[model samples]
Target: MDSPICLIENLNGTLSVNEQAIDYLMGLEQKIVVVAIVGLYRTGKSYLMNKLARSKTGFALGGTIQSKTKGIWMWRVDHPAKADRAIILLDTEGLGDVEKGDSKSDAWIFALSILLSSTLIYNSRGTIDNDAVEKLQPNRYVTELTELIKVKASSGASSADDEEGSGSQFVQFFPNFVWVVRDFTLQLELNGKDIDADQYLENSLKLKKGFGKNISDYNMTRDCIRNFFPTRKCFVFPFPATVEKMQLLDTLEDKQLSKKFSSTADTFCRFIYENSPVKTILGGKTLTGRMLGHLINTYVATINSGNVPCLENAILAMAELENQAALEDAFVMYKKEMEVVKALFPVDSSHLSENHLKSQTRSTHAFMERSLKDTDGKYSAILAGKIKEYANNLFEENQDASEKKCKALLDKLSATMDHGVKEGTYSTPGGYELYCDHHDTLMARYRAEPNKGVKAEEVLEQFLKEKSAESSSILQADIKLTENEKHIQAEKNKTSQMAQEKAALDERH
Candidate 1:
C-alpha cells in the first residue's frame, strides 16, 4: 500500500468526532463511581484531586480559599486519546469544624453518604487529633455506621449479598506519621517519656498507650467500630505537613527515598482494587462507558476523514519532508510511556489537546528540517558569512561565535534520541542534540573510518528505525481505534431505540 498517510489528519478526524461521542457515552451513566478526598482544610485534598485529573481546577479551589469553611465539590474525568479510563473525583468539606452552626450532624450525613456510595480517600495529613480525624470518631461517624449496620443486620439486610455490596475493607495502620514542624521543632512526648527527636518508630503498643489511650483512640476505635461492623475494615495513614523540612520532602524523588512513599501509595491502591463495590466501580468492565467515549471520538474523526490510508500517507510525506519524523516518533513513544510518566508525577489528560498535538507536530517538523539544512544546506556559504558578521557585532573577541553557532546546531542534531522521555515532562526542545550527541559522535565516526565512512542512507536507516520503534509503542492506541468502530456499529444497531427514547424524553421536557 502506497506508504499509508500520516497520523496527523487521522488524529484530527478522530478528535473532532470523539468529542460528541464522549457526551453520549457519559450521558448513559451505566457505570459511575464517585471517589471522595476528605481531610482537614488546606491538607491538600483539592491538590491531590487536581493531581489525579491533571488539571488546575483543584488548584483554583485552593486559590479560592479565603478562610476555613465547608463546601463540597465534584469533578468528572474523561479518557485520554490513548487510554480507556474514566474517573469521577469528589471533594468533601473539611470535617471537624464548619464556620457556622452545628455541622456535626451534617458532616456525619455527608460522610455516611460517601461511605455508602463511594471509595473513601481520606487525607494522609489528617491524624489522631487532626480535626478531620476527630470527626470520624466511633461516637460520631463510625457510631452512625455501627448503628446502620445494626439496623441492617436486624432488618435482615446483613446477608452475604449485602456484605459484598457494602464494599468496605479492614484496617491497616501506617507506621510513621510526619508532623509538619515548619522551620521549628517542638518536643513530642511519647508514653509519658520525653522521646529524643530525630526520627522514631513507635510499636503498636506504644501507639495504643500514647495516641490510642481510650476507645476514642484509633486502634481501640476499631474495636467499637467492629462491634457494629464485624465485616467492615478501616485504615490509617499519618502524614506530617511540617513547614520546616517541607522543601526537602517535597523535592525528594521516589528513588531517593527507597520507595517509602511509593510503597504507601501501592497499599492504598491495593485496598481500593480489592474492595467489593469499589472493585466493580474501577473495574475495566464498568469503565466501558468511558472507554467507548474514546472509541467514539476516534471513530467520528475517522468517518470525517474518510480514507485512513490516504490521510496517513499525506501527513507522513509532509512530516518527513519537513523533518518531523522524530516528532511523529515522539508522540508514539508518549503512548507507551504514559504509565511511567504518571508514576513519577501523576497527570491528567486534560492538558493534552488536539490543537496542542498538532502544534507540537508542526514545530518538531520545522525544527528537524532546520537542523539538517543549517548543517549542510545550499546557503551554507552565505549563512556562514552572515553569521561571521553577526558574531563580530557582539564584541571584538567574538569572531569565533559565528562558527560556533553553526557547529552547535550540527552538534544538537547529532545528539537527538539518546535519552527516553523524562518523567513528569510533557515536551522536549526539538533538534539533533535532542536526538543524540551529534557533533562529537559524527566527528568520531568520520575519524574512525575516514576512507570507509558513513553515508546518507545509513543515517536515514537509523532515523527510520527510531521512528518505527516509536510507532510500535502502545497497542492501546491501536485497540482504541478498533473499539471506536465497535461503538459505531453498536450505535447503528440501537439507533431506532435511541431515537424513540430521545423523543419521549424531549416530549416530557
Candidate 2:
C-alpha cells in the first residue's frame, strides 16, 4: 500500500537506502527473480505491472500525462508458480515523457532497468514498424551500452575477455527482450492466412530501408538487437479500450466510468502469466532481493562518475561490498559480547583478581573467533579470513595487557604474605595453602575454557617461585643465627661455674 522502496530518484538521480534493501533481501530466505517493464511515458507500463502483480490498488496508475513512477519502484511478491522463489516486480519511469524530455538521464534509467531485469518488456503504443522498431531500439541507446563497455574497458574495470565494446560484457545481462505492441491497427492475417505475432515482427524486421545517407546506422542498430539479444519475444495486444474509455478509467469512478473500462484484458494477462518463467532467472542470476542495491550502486556509481557499467565488474563489486558488510556485522556482534565478558572480571585488587582478568580475556577472544568464522553464502573467504586475522591480533593484544595485570597483582600479594610469615603469624608453608586457595577458586571458573585454567596455573607457579626464593634465603639465615646463640649460652654457663669453684677453694685455704 505504501509505495515500495524507490531505488533511484527519477529527476534528482539519487539512489537511496541501498544497504537496508540489501539486508532485507538477504533475509527473505527465498530465491529472488525479477520481472520489469520499460517504455515511453504514458504507455500503460504501471498499469501493466499492477496487472502482473495481480493487484488493483497498489502500483499507482497515472490519469494525466505526468509519469506516476518517477524513479525505479519495486514490489516484492511470491512467485505465482514456484513456492521456493520470490518475484520482484519493477516499474520504471517512462522515457520520452513531456515533463522530462528524452535526455541522458532517461537513457540511464532505460539501461539500468535492462541490466536489472530477467524478463524485460519493451512496451509501445502503436503497430510495429521500422520507425517504431527504430525508436524502440535507438542508435544512441545501443551505442551507449557499447560506449559504456568502452569506458569500462578503458578504465580497466573489467577483465580481459569481458572488456567494454566486447559482446560478452554487454550481452551477459541482456534480458529476454519482449516487444509488446499495445495497439495493433494492421491485419494479423495476410492474404487469407493467419499470421502469428512473431511472423508479423519478422516482416517488420525484414523491411528494407528507404534511401538516406548514414541510414546504415539505423540498419546496424536494428541488426544489433536482432543479432545480439539472447532471445526475442513478440506480442501484439489489440487496442484495449477507446481513448474516451481510457480517459474515463483515469478521470472517473466506476459509476462515472463506462462498462467498456470493465472489460478485462484477460488473454493478455494470461499470456504474460504463462510466458513468465517459473523462476525468471531460471538457470542464470540477475534479480535477487539482496543483490538489488549492489547492482544499482554498481551501475549508478559508474554512470554518475561519467563511466560505463560492465556486468562482470558489477559482480565483482557486489562480492566485495557484501563481504565487507558481513565483516562489519560480525565485529558489531563481537564487541557487544566482549563488553559482557569484560564485566565478569573480579572487582577486588587481590591474588584472585589476575585470574579473573585472564579468564575474561580468554572469553572475549573466544567470542570473537566464533563470530568471525561463522558466515553465510561463502562470503569472500579471503576477506572473511582477513577479519579472522584481526581477531587473532586482538587476542594477542589483550593477553599482553592481562599479563601485565597478573604480574603487578602477584608482586603486591607477595609483599603482604611475606610479612605475615616473618612476623610469627604463620609457618613459612602456611601461606602456601592460602595462596593456592585463591588460585583454585578462579581456576575452577575457567574450566569451560581449559587453556585459560592452564594459563592461570602458570601465573600462580611463577608467583610461588618468587616467594619461595625470598623465604628460603631468610630461613637459612635464621638457622645460622640460632646455632650461634646456643653455643654462646653453653660457654657462658661453664665460665660462671668455674669462677664459683675457684672462689670456694681460696676461702677454704
Model 2: CA > 4 A from native: 4-7, 10-32, 64-86, 98-106, 137-152, 155-169, 184-221, 239-244, 248-291, 294-323, 326-452, 469-509
Best by lDDT: 2
TM-score of every candidate relative to the true structure? 0.32, 0.60
lDDT of 2 by residue, 1-509 (tens): 24456656665654343455556666664666667888888888877776677676566788787888887888777666778777777888887666765467777777877777777888888887667776765436654566544324335544424554445545555666777787666778767899988777766666256757567755655665765475777777665566767754434443553343233345555655556553322225434455566667778788778867766577667756655565566545555554454454322233234443454455445433322222353543543464456545545545555555565555554565556556744433344455455445434433333223213545667765766775565566556656777888889988988988999999999
Best candidate per TM-score, number? 2
Candidate 1 runs further than 4 Å off: 1-26, 29-33, 63-71, 79-85, 112-118, 124-135, 148-220, 224-509
| Local accuracy of candidate 1 as per-residue lDDT tens digits, 2-50 | 1111111112112233244345444543454445555555555654555
* Candidate 1 positional error at 41, Å: 2.8
